[model samples]
Target: MIESDIKRYELLLDLLQKSKKEQDEQNNTLDQKCSSMINILILIITIQCGIYANVALLNEIASSEIAIIIKVLLIITLIGNFIALYFFIAAYYLKDFEGMTNEEDIIKYGENNTNLETIYKEISVDYKRTIEENKIELSKIDKIKLGFKIVTLTTGIFVLTIIICLEILI
Candidate 1:
């Protein structure tokens, strides 16, 4: 019975470790995507500013109606970018789950000549706690993913609108 219990604990620990590794990988991927989007946004804003400056320098202002349309488009782009940025920043601020045990700790516990039942109980508790923590982390990641999708969609719309406005001005 004790042997089977030990094996169960080991299996649980292995599964938890695998889950944590997968979560870490996903977090890194999402972080990279968010960073890439932010960079793209910056580039878009820079290009738009440059175009506006060139037009101003060349005294090529469009008709008042077109100018107003351009202004509205610019505002929409700015607001969308702002909302996206806010969500990205919120996602960045989320804390990662903690409370998982390391191999060293398990080894140390074993070396201490601890009772098998005690060790099993401790591992079981830790396993349960970690499972809960992982659930919460997964939920947060889902939210972050949703936020990133919103940002991507908003930025795309902004880019298309700006392109149309630029064509009108030209």
Candidate 2:
């Protein structure tokens, strides 16, 4: 009965992983399309402002140079968003392809790979066999989560810096 329960639990976890993977894929695709559309729209707006609207704005303003500069800044803002999006999408995809991401898909697709399972089984056994095992209050699960958090946080911060620079330029 216990074995059956374990098997059932494993199946549930596998389903969860697959669901998570699908969610991640959908989110990623949405992000890419959304970002591209936003960038293109922003570019169009900047062009309009520079070629047509800015003439009227400059008429009301004291300096044409400042109007042109403002348009340039708007374009720069779009570029900044592109950079940040590129960074985020690249990281997500690379992690996904490697099956190293903390995504639920990782759990679903991970253990099914026969070779990887064998390697991980050895690693898990060795780690447990070591006297230092279980020294941390947190479970192995927590450690994996923490590692992913660290990576995500680091990349997010750098992306934020680019955003900040865009703001400052604006």
Candidate 3:
């Protein structure tokens, strides 16, 4: 019976590890996908701003040919923006993006799509609301964690720099 219990525990650990790996993979893919979408969105905004600026410049020039070209460029920018947005909505930001992952893994891990949805919602809202809504205790904990991270990083960098300096001096 002891041996059977040990075997069961080991099996449970293995299953948990597998689920964690799957979750990690999904998170990585989502991160990459979202970042690309964000970059495209930024680029589109920049181009639209540029087109507006060009139109203003053309108006100042009062040249009909230049004004026509500027209008054509603006139209092209609008079409390109629409196509990019369509692709962004269809490929990167699926209406049911969270539905791609398995639901069963949540029960095993004690987490579900709801938490993921909350994160997505927070992302859409610029993540500020989530930060603001968190408990004050979490901020304190975060400060402690940040201090520890800074100390550790500084110590490691100091050690490396000292070693390099000594090697160079010798």
TM per prediction: 0.72, 0.32, 0.36
User: Which residue pairs collide, candidate 2?
Assistant: none
Model 1 Cα lDDT, one tens digit per residue, 1-170: 46887888778767866776776677677777666766776776676566555444223456766565665665666666666666666666565666667898799888998887677767767876775675545545665667667667766766776676667657
- On TM-score, who's better, 1 or 3? 1
- Model 3: per-residue Cα lDDT over 1-170, one tens digit each: 25565566556555544554565465456546545754765675575666456455445554666456546545554554555444444434332212222456446334544543343333334323332332133333343344334434433543453353344345
Clashing residue pairs in candidate 1 are none
RMSD of each: 3.5, 13.0, 21.0
Q: Stretches of candidate 3 above 4 Å error?
A: 1-27, 39-43, 46-57, 95-170
- In order of lDDT, best first, we have 1, 3, 2
Model 3 earns a TM-score of 0.36
Winner of 1 and 2 under lDDT: 1
